[model samples]
Target: MAKATRWRNFTRSEAFSGYVLVSPTAIYAVLLLAAPLATIVAFSFFKDGYLTVIREFTLQNYVDTWSDPVFRAILLRSLFVSGMVTLTTVLIAFPIAYYISFNVSRSMKSRWLFLITIPFWTSYLIRVFLWKVILGYNGVINSTLDIVGLIDQPLNMLNNVQAIVVTLAHAYAPFAILPIFVALEKIDRALLEAGQDLGESRLMTFWRVTLPLAMPGVVAAVLIVFIPTIGDYVTPQLIGGGKVPMVANLIQARMLDLDNKPMGSAIAVSAMAIVTLVSLLFLFLNRRFLRVQK
Candidate 1:
């Protein structure tokens, strides 16, 4: 009777429903995400032949991937561009998120969030193309500047690293903002009030109490912006004008243009490894701040 009662409780507990609820997503991840990731990792160890992947296991693909100067340059450039975009997006986003959380009335907060997400109403590819148009020679900015006599000729804005950064920062702004807003909203108002009561200035209280509490959202914002921007293909292709190729472009070139799947897989693995290490390092460095809000 006791065993039967325990079994009945177990069936209705959150642990059971949690499993039931998560099973579909877990299965989907295993089939769609893990399987392809395993395939890529497996291919990274194989050898590339003339229009064929050699089944023989070897470390030569990784060795050659690391040895290539072009790959190193492109990978470094990708990291730099992604880092700039993350910084630009987060720094700009924090203020907007704070304003919405602390200043906007509860009634108006939804409208503000709605406005923030207006950029998402359009397709991402269309947005990238729009950025291309904005920064292109004889495009909106150049045309307006010329009309106002700002320069002698149209500037070469497109096909550069800066253009890539600007396009990505704008694209990922909403992502950064939402996470940060969620974080800022979770902060207790009493904590800020207590800090001020304890003789801390508003700025100092925010520095000590507010920012630390919001660190998780900030970290989430950083990782969300950083990871995808590093692997971005469309922005580099459109905004960089195919001249400033990042890691994604190189991977595409290897996988498709050169028909070297192993080499492409190797590059992809290396990039994933680097991103993982950077993300771990960031988490480690921010462990203190993460513990604060708790």
Candidate 2:
């Protein structure tokens, strides 16, 4: 009884210390993320236009946003592009992650993982621009095709939807791969042995054991890749040829170009709501799958 009481006292003190340590980060998030988000919410409901001080509450901005065809189109395009990029990244990253996790020596695994990190040391804009140069009409792809006599004229590679997906996929591939690799590495060798002992073939063992165990990584990869790529405006602007605009671009144009702050805030809030809903759905599915496996 005395020991149990002492252990409880020790746990209470440790919990207090841990909270003390995390308190600064919690405060920082409030100062940065919470404050700005609250301000955006407040501004989203403001009555008048940019200059008008109509402090009265109104849903006019949201109504206008929903009615705008351009905003709706932009939102759909963002979802499509982000979905494509996320799927492609996962497909490409999966095999690489599997090989590294299951086949490579520990020493080589560390080296290759380090190589992935090397790309992050450079400017993101510079890396993206490199893709632009490679995919441009007069760029390496065109030059190669021309030299091979594949076509008479340069292909219009710039300012297109394909270019946006390709560039974003390339940019975000590491994010997908790392999570998958970590998950794959966490898998137990005993599970494979158990499957084999149960007369499962190699493919069956992988399907029944490996894939199920690594699903958390898969979900993580998808969420990480999908969420940001869908909201990205820069890649769309650079490679989407000004012809295709994602929701982010629309928000940017409304906020800065058109000087319509209320509409922009409304759009921002709506996007946040959509993202939150999607994320919750993903989490629910992940948990359901996890429970089934168990």
Which numbered prediction scores highest in lDDT against the true structure? 1
Those runs of model 2 whose alpha carbons end farther than 4 Å from true positions after fitting are 1-12, 50-53, 290-294
Spell out the clash pairs found in candidate 2. 159-241
Q: Whole-model Cα lDDT per candidate?
A: 0.95, 0.88
Q: What lDDT score is found at residue 236 in candidate 1?
A: 92
Candidate 1 global lDDT: 0.95
Worst 10 residues of 1 by lDDT: 285-294
Leading candidate by TM-score:
1
Q: Least lDDT summed over 10 consecutive residues: which range in candidate 2?
A: 47-56
lDDT of 2 by residue, 1-294 (tens): 999999778768978789879999999999999999998888889865555535779999999988988878878778888888988999999999999998999889999898877878888788888988999889999999999999899999988888999999999999999999999999998989988998999998988789888998999999999888878878888887678888888889878888877778899998878877877898898888778876
Cα RMSD for candidates in order: 2.6, 3.9
Task: Give Cα distance to truth, residue 65, candidate 1, Å.
Answer: 0.6
